[model samples]
Structures are given as structure tokens and as C-alpha cells.
Target: MSGTDRRYRHGLVLGKFYPPHAGHHHLVRSALARCERLTVLVCAASVESIPLADRVAWMREAHPEAEVVGAVDDHPVDLLDPAVWEAHMAVFRAAVPEAVDAVFTSESYGTELARRFGAAEVGVDPERTTYPVSGTAVRKDPVGSWTFLGPGVRAALTRRVVVLGAESTGTTTLSRALAAHYRTRGGIWSETGWVPEYGRTYSEERLAALRAVDPGADWTQVEFGSEEFPVIARRQDADEERAARDGSPVLFCDTDSFATTIWHERYLGAPSPEVAAVAARTARHLYLLTDHEGVPFEDDGLRDGPHLRPWMTGRFRAELERSGRRFLLVTGSPEERLRTAVAAVDGLLAEGWHFADPLPERR
Candidate 1:
């Protein structure tokens, strides 16, 4: 039948969708193509780490035309038992009470499930030849299946590492070096992502705007408004999100929205709660702070005096401590600092992704 053929009046696509992957999406799209109307039901168990609402949201974003619904199904799977089948159906029916003409799935139990629903069984990619991915594989090792995952899922699962410190303290250098180190491992690591400092871009733009009116104007002539800090923070966070979607499992950031709050204070001579709120939007996994000590401060026209370095470093340390964020102080030679940074990141990756085990199946 053609893709636009409405073979099924009302179709149903149901799955645990613990975390929506490309395979699940392909199944849903196939069902949509065959049916006039489609409903993608996402069932998540109580023990699952990823929230049901989040899965629903991801599905909605992925397939906006389809009606996406979520339900809490804590029942264990046992295709052999009729009693277990009934129990599972009770939860499923509660979420989707409307009549279903076709039930689409890749599971072996699709025949019985469609029989019970009085609907035709529409099998799709049962052998996993098309996408060749599953939620279990993603939960176990996201890096291995990074290419199979969509942008929203990648943004959520990506381990974000931010490198930040006072101006002229090698923040950009360390971030790029870290990304380069990861890329050497090859495979998925070769695609390791790095997000640049959006604040610098904003600074350059501001200086250019100043120079537009006065061609000889220097960086000192550039002025900042309290309202602009939040804009910069939001843009930095957005840039990180874009990189995480297409990059490897781990992503490196030169400076994040969180660091923008400190810069806001430095420029405006006071704290900015608005900028802090913007910073809170990102999930930064680790932070590497480059110590200004023993490092020559280059006046890049945008940098402040050397005396401000100690104060800025102290502020970052104190804020990180108060906020209870995990951070490493990069002191000593450049080589030693890279070693320390690599070790810290390695320790974090060593922990691996933790997914709560689902309820054991029973016969």
C-alpha cells in the first residue's frame, strides 16, 4: 500500500519508550503513513529513571501530528501468561480508551496484543534491520548509539563539561585541548563536541557597534547593559545544546551560561539574579577552573587588570563551593593542568550512566 493509503482508520503504537530512540520513531512514522489517524502511547514503569512525561514530550516534539499519550505501567512483561496480559491491558486501556483498528509494533507479542484489542497486527522492523537500536542499548551505553538517537535525547543524555575562569586565563585553550584529546580515541569519540564562548562573540559585536559610530573606538569604549547579560547566558546555553545534539557522548564548553553570571557582576559591579536564572537552565556535569597564578595575563583589549584575576578566581571558587558543584582547580604548568583535567573527566566517565533496573519479568 502507498504511504498515504488509509488502510487503518485508527491506529495505535504502544511501547515502554523508556527513552525514545530512532527505531521507535521509525515505527511510529510507519504507522502514521498507513493510518488516517495515529496514537503513540508511551508506557513507562515506576523503576525507570527517565520520566514518562519527558518521553511523551520527546515523542510529541518528534511527531507533532500524532497524538502522544503517556501512562504509568509498572507491570512486568510475561507474554506466556494470560493473567499478566490482562493486567498490562488494564493499564494500557485506561490511557487509550478509544477504539483501535490497527495495533503496530515490532514485539513478538504483537499478534496476541492485536487479537486482544480486536485490531489487526501491523509488524514493523521486527528484525531490527532498519535502525538496529533499543532502549536497553541506549541506557547501557549512550556513546555507542549516539548516532541513532535524536537531538532531544542527545541533549538530555550528553555529559556537558564546562571550562571557565577569569579573562586571559586559557579557558578557550583548555576547552579545545580537551576536545582534541577525546577525538584521538577515534570511533564515536572522534565526534566529541566543543562549544565556544558566546560572550566573546557578543563582546566583539558590541565593540564593532561602538566602532561603527566611532571608527577609532577601542574595547574600553564598549558599554554593557544589565539586560544584555541574560541574553548572552541564554545564547551560550543554546549553543551548547546544538553541539550536544550532533556530537559524541561527552561535550566540552569553553564557558557556559553559569560563568556569565560572574561576568555580569564584573562588568556591572553587582550581582545579577536574572543572569543566574538563565545559567540554571543547563545541566553542566563538570567544571575545570584554570588558576591565574603563575600564568601570564595577556591584555586582549577585553581583559581586565591582573589584580582582578585573583578576585575573579576567588569568586568562582567560592560560588562553586556554595553551589555544591563538582570542580577541579587547574594549577601548575600547561601539561600538568591538562593531565589533571583529563584525569577528572576520565573519573566522571568511569562512573558510567546509571539507569534504574526495570522490574524483573515473571512467567
Candidate 2:
């Protein structure tokens, strides 16, 4: 019989496999059906959040027929580096009994690996599966995207949402509610559990590093100079370039380098010509949350002063108007905050905003 007619002896699946979800299961099942033997190599050097053994167990439970293997430990290296590919290939060569007949991957690297190993490579189109998903997509909306995960995997993800906000706002209450909502929806809800006050996290080490840097360094002097102003102004231009290349929608950021420049001038008293130029180039869609009825001021550690609320709100609005950007003022109780945020997201979605990052294209 020809090679095509012969039963494939072995197949390999490689990935981080943080928690094997539906897409992963579909790929494994397809591979198992096509090959006499299957091996799964789970990358161990993922983020500190998930353990390697847990990832292996997740894959094993989902594909019991496959021989699941953990990747060999090596000094962490950046995957983007050209040299890393050869190093990774060495590891794979050592782990498998012999060069596998076929390699399975969702990434373009699968094709490259096939060329290198002299084996048939298959790029599985994950979108064709029962629940098409990706790790990055899963990370962006863990609670809402739980349906794509397996029963055991969904339970594990419940404990890992990160909610970030600035002082005196209802971030603490909101964070708790978000976690509770995830649980109520029958998924894992991971957060810090309580809002830890801001300064509690900022350490003296950062302060010392800032102080150690020379105020009159050549780079600093150049940044503050007129000739270098336009060069620094190109920071936003870079973001625009990225957006163009990826066909992603523009996000009107609440904070930008321009705001940082203003804060430096106002709080640090370090105004410069370059700072003005930087501020002038920033594009924004400022959404100033204003004081409203029933939104009582609470004594959170970061928001203790009585005058800061109105003063900061006024300043924020003034900055937006001065900068000549489209803005909207949102004011109301906690319920109103949620409504306003949801409405803004919906508006962006309706406008067909595409994310710059690699993700499933908006339907």
C-alpha cells in the first residue's frame, strides 16, 4: 500500500494547554481517529498562574487514548527569537520515541515543523469545531466564554479575573460583584477577593529607582527639547501604524502618554516643550465619570480627601475640552455606571470596532 493508505503510526499535538477546552478536545479526537498512536506535549513554561501538572492532567482527562507528555525543562527563552525554534525542536526530538509521522497544530509553526522534521503536518482549522475558541480569546472574557470550556476546565477558570481601577471609585464593590456574578453563572471566578488599597502595592523600590535616574541625562534633555518633540510625538503615530496593519478598531483610551505628561507637569512640576507637543498629539474619547445622585462618597484608602472628587472631575473635563477630543460625561449611581459602560461597549461594537490583537474576527 502507498504511504497515504498505510495507517499513520504516530501523531503529535503541542501547546501550552493552560486548561484544555473544547477546541483542544476536537483537535485531539480528530488526531486520534487518523493515527494509530498519539502523543501530546504540553508546554511547561507558561505563566505562573497555572501549574504544568494541572495542564497535563487536563489533556489526559480529555484524551485518554493519547500518551500525554510534559515538555522537558529548559531555561526560559523568548519564543519570538529565531534561535528558540531550533532549541524547541531539539527538545521535541528527544521527547518523542522517534520522529513522528505527523504533527498537529493550530499555529502556522506546524507547517514549518513538518518541513524541518520531514513529517506530514496538519493545521487544524479550530473554527470548524463544535466550540471554536483560542487561549487568548478565552483570557479576554473568561466568564462569558466559559461555554467553550470543558466541565472541569470551566470550574478552574472561575478563580482568575483581574479587575483594575483607580482610587475612591467603586472598584472594590464592583470587583466583588463581578466575581459573584461569574459564580452565579456557574463558572470559575478568580479575583483578588477584595480591593487592596493602591499605595499598598507600590513599593519603595520603584521610588528609589525613579530617584536614582539622572534628571539632566542626555536622553531626558533631548526628550524635553524642541527638535526631539516631534520624534516623541510619533508615539501615537506608532499605535496608528499598528492599527492600520492589523485592521483593528481604534480604542479611545482613558489614559495616554499625554495625560502622563500633564500629570508630570501638575504634580511633579516638570513641564517641558516636549510635554506640550506630546499632549497636543494624543487622540482620545474621554468619558468623565461625574458626581451623581445616590453615589455617596466612601472613605476608601485612596479617596480620603473631600475636595478631590469634584476637583479631579473638573480637571478631567477641562483637559478633554482643551485637548479637542470627543467626550461624554457619565453620571449616576452604581447601576448607572454599569449601564453607561455597557452602552459604550455596545456603541463601539455597533460601530464595528475590531481589536488590533489576533482573535476570532467579529461576526
Candidate 3:
């Protein structure tokens, strides 16, 4: 039967969706409109880094109307190889519990896939007329192709604006304000917010666990080592990434691993090479340095004494300068710091800043 004339009872579409984008959305939407029901199989290779379950979750969240399934298949993605295609087809069949009446896809292999499944082929936007972006292109330049991504995938490629400085320098306050501002309309980037500091949260959680086990445990006496910083650094990265997966276009970080590294040195006398390496590898779009001048220092159980704030702040500045990273020094009242941060973000927007791959290190 002809593609247009035949009605599909149950349609199937499968793809990696390495990071799902608008193009995938378009294909799914088109399939849903034509078929009575659609089953999207998010088949990921065993070798891919992104979690298959996470991708499946996004698909379900994105298209609640369709039935989404996640599966791990070690078969080759290349459909041109007969042996490989046969192996993949077997996995595809097993992934779907019931019979599929039609196969929906944008790739040229949809005809062969449908034939193998004993179903009709429904090609949607194979010529890329509707959505002209690919997963590979999105990976290479996510910031450039930001418009094509959904919130979850957008977070995967988000540019970070880290609000870093000494304790009580309005880092948390500024980060929350920045998030609120972005969530409101009429700005360069709206409906976006910031990621809270994971380091402090993790510490608080660990301390609470200790307290739970030992009621008389003193929070002030908590000790740390080089290993702790690396763990904190990794968790900090995880928190930022998880928040960004569904957060705004510009993710304002209350603090980053870079700050964690400084704290490591202050407390442990030396930062672990692992933590330092992680901080150096991940690049941020901009660093807004909050000066301690005229800011009140309130003691949180985790913070060092107010007297050491300036020294810590200086070390942060030194780290930024030594790394030759972009930074903006923000001082004055809370309102002033927010204004400066906003202006910096606005400037970035004006310049059409898109996150690109880090350049090769110089000799």
C-alpha cells in the first residue's frame, strides 16, 4: 500500500537521541498525527556515555501521548552492513513486545527497516525540510544550535556563569537573584535560573548523616582531606549538570569546582591533582568575582572565619588571573552586585556567545 493511503495502527520510531533535539520532536509529532498510537524506542549502544534510562525518561516527559521504551543494544548502528542490520533488527524486534504496523524515521534506512519488520515505511522529513539539524552537529556546537534543543538536552550543553568569591560575599544571594531575573520575561535570556552550590549541600548532607549516627557529633570538628575535594568537585559538577538538564539557557552557578579547589587548599593545605584537573578541564563562560568589601559575614557551620574572607577572595582572583580566564570584579551593595552581574550576562548575549570546545593547550 502507498504510504499516504495506508493507515498505521501502531507506529514505531527508534533512534539514539544522544541528546534529543527539536528534529526528533518533529519526527515524533508527525508520527503521532498520522498513527493511532506511536511507540518510540530509545535504543542506545552499550558504549554511549549518556544513560539510556534518562533519554527514555525525557522522551516520556516530552511526549506523554506516546509509549516510550529504553533498551541497551550492542549491535552496530550502521544499517548498510547486512550482518549488522540483521543483528540490530533482532534487538529491535525484541524491544517491542507487540507487532508494529509501520516504521517511522527520517533516515533512508526506514524502507529496509520497515521491510524487515514486515511493516509499511513512513518517512518523515527525510530531506530535512522541517528540522535541519543532526545529533552530531548538536554535540559539536550545542550553544550555536541552542534553539534546536529541548530543556533537558539544552542543560547538557549550557554555558555556565559562575558567581564565585569568599563566603558571605553575596554569592548565594546574587545567584538566586540572577535566577529569578532570568526566569522573568524581557531579558536577553528569560525563563532560566541558576544552580545552587552542591558543595555546601553535600557537606551539610554528610554532616547530617554523621549527626544521625552520632547525636553528639560536632559539626565544627569535621575534618577533610585531598580525597574529599575531588568527591565534592565531582558532585558539584553532577549537581550543575543535573540542574542544567532542565534549567535555563544560562545557568548561574553559585560556586564551582574552581572555588572548591581554593577551599581545598585553605583547609587541607593542598588540592588533589584530580580535583584540580577536573576544574581546569571544564570551562565556564564567565566568572563574576564578588568582593568582600562592605558585605556582612554570617557564620554558617561550613564557612571559615570572616577574617580569612579576604585571603580566600584574593586566592580566587589569583587563580582566575593565572588561568587567564574571563572574569568580572563585582563589589558594592547587593543591588550593585546584581546589576553588574546582569550587565555582564547582557554583554555576553549581545556578543552571541556560544559555548565551543576548549582549544588545544599551548606548549
Worst 10 residues of 3 by lDDT: 354-363
In candidate 1, stretches whose alpha carbon ends up further than 4 angstroms from where it belongs are 1-6, 76-84
TM-score against truth, every candidate: 0.94, 0.42, 0.64
Candidate 2 residue-wise lDDT, 136-199, digit = tens: 6665655455566764554343222222223355544544443343334332222212223222
How does residue 345 of candidate 3 score in lDDT?
Answer: 87
Candidate 2: residue 72 Cα off by (Å): 4.7
Candidate 1, residue 84: the lDDT equals 89
Best model number under lDDT: 1
Q: Clash pairs of candidate 3?
A: 155-244
lDDT of 1: 0.89
Q: What residue runs in model 3 are displaced by over 4 Å at the alpha carbon?
A: 1-20, 28-122, 125-148, 186-190, 209-219, 353-363
RMSD of each: 2.2, 15.0, 8.3
Local distance difference test values of all predictions, in order: 0.89, 0.53, 0.81
> For this target, which candidate reaches the highest TM-score against the unseen true structure?
1
Error of 1 at 28 (Å): 1.6
Residue range 16-69, candidate 1, lDDT tens digits: 887889999999999998889999999889988998888999999999989999
